[model samples]
Target: MTHNTDLPDVVPIFPLPGALLLPRARLPLHLFEPRYLAMLDDALKTPQRLIGMIQPNKVPGRSGSGLHTIGCVGRVTQFSETEGGRYMITLAGVSRFRLIEEVEGFTPYRRARVSWAGFERDQGPEEGDTAFDRGAFLQTLSQYFDSQDLQTDWDSLKEADDELLINSLSMLLGFEPEDKQALLEAPCLSTRRETLMTLIEFAMRGGDGEGMLQ
Candidate 1:
């Protein structure tokens, strides 16, 4: 993990909604769009090979839209260019950063000046045995998964520690963008666990107008 002190003044980002990558988590991307393919190409040339995963407020004009401010910065740990003009890459998250401002650059993809000051703690591993309500979280998650008819490995789920289990479910579950953003912005693991539980219950009750839960 790169120290917040060592993070660059600016980093290129891919403003994709409904797509999220959290610190210490891994996100695999299919770079098929021309602009994003170009972004991937440029990222691989640098030693850091980093990209910020963030949600955009609205449609981007030439200048792009308002970003949600906080995002996870990850390094391109794997890359492969397909013969069909596509790129496959895996980003291993390093730290979260706040978008300070946009940088006017010549690159095809957008660039942002970011500040990692408050998110310095994201560099290390998640705390062990957090005060989060693990039992309730897993139980609700099991109910939600069963409702969705999604198979699960109960033994493997038990092996996941607090941070891994919480963040993994947060990312993998199909929650509304607002719900996802809430989980991302939660101040700590305990809060995030509680938020996840609430969101699941809401979905189960058909709060989103859909009979099924996300």
Candidate 2:
């Protein structure tokens, strides 16, 4: 038999600039700031160490402005102590959420009331087979990597599963902020793949093959 636990009433928050997380994916974070150290402590004390990962326009002290309405919630699945009381942690994406409202009267870190509606909807590629222009896609990726003079294990790349291939390529390509948002919000893996190709073509034509390398 299986049982379900009521969702936790508390949500922890973490904001990053220009970073995104897909469902079931993982993000590694280094927590050293005093505010975030407090967050880590709160999470460690709670049964659910859930944090909302958002992208800020600038680092906290620099600007603390421009945040996306959508973000992913993740749990600190792994944590370890580091020098100087810092923390190294890996957060596994649980779901995407929409910022409902910002709440005050809490800890130093920013807090928000969020909802995960439409998060688990039909957003991934169809189970089983995802059709794509494999030959053309590989050719484009190879040429792009080559033009950038970046070394990649072709064999490993070839062997990479579709999710890994798409997400990795998406990250490597330095797409504009809006473009990255579109890719993350794409309806399915195949659609995301298509967007990736479009970005690659744009890069190739603009002599921006190195953009992805950085």
Candidate 3:
């Protein structure tokens, strides 16, 4: 793992579409793409099984085929070997990075020179939405879960800290791709929480009152 320094020696990158990972959160990924499989193998061999998760600008073989500028670097915390030699791994997010430049590499996966200078500032609880009531949020989540018939281990849920609870909820909920990205890019925890509340409200509304005529 790279220390909390301005510059680092090596930066490992993992680019995918519509996937967002935030700091202090966990993301589980299944390796199937040949290029990414190679990337995962290379990462596992190294000390910092660290990968920068960026969104691809366009689909492969399409006109615009590149990735976005900013992404988070996650380190492999747990991994499992599957029957087909595929990997089931969980990444714990560390910090965000700004893409500096792409380097030529042997594998198909993209490699980039990145810098952490941009993300060193405050990513604290959001302003204006500072009046967050955790108790109310939990009660609301319980009601929402009941309505959806979703079962959770209440003891664990009750024990989760503010950051973990909010990030986990935002990640698992069935939000639109754009919306999910928005939540991932939110600058602070309060903003994320506020965005989640809006999402929860929308879900409660059910299809925005416009379903198929059938």
Q: Assess the local accuracy of residue 100 in candidate 3 as a C-alpha lDDT between 0 and 100.
A: 73
Q: Which of the numbered candidates is closest to the native, going by highest TM-score?
A: 1
lDDT of each: 0.79, 0.69, 0.72
For model 3, what is the error of residue 181's alpha carbon versus the real structure, in angstroms, after optimal superposition? 1.2
60-88 in candidate 1: lDDT tens per residue?
55223477787888999988888898888
* Residue pairs in candidate 3 whose N, alpha carbon or C atoms collide under 3 angstroms: none
Worst 10 residues of 1 by lDDT: 205-214
lDDT of 3 by residue, 1-214 (tens): 3455633545667876557788767899998777878888888888678877877654354223376667888888998878787888898877777777888877778878887765653233313335779788878888778777899988888887777778888778766655666676677788889888877776776754221110
Model 3: ten consecutive residues of lowest lDDT: 205-214
User: Considering lDDT, which of the candidate structures 1 and 2 is the better prediction for this target?
Assistant: 1
TM-score per prediction, in order, is: 0.90, 0.80, 0.79
- The deviation in Å at residue 172 for candidate 3 is 1.7
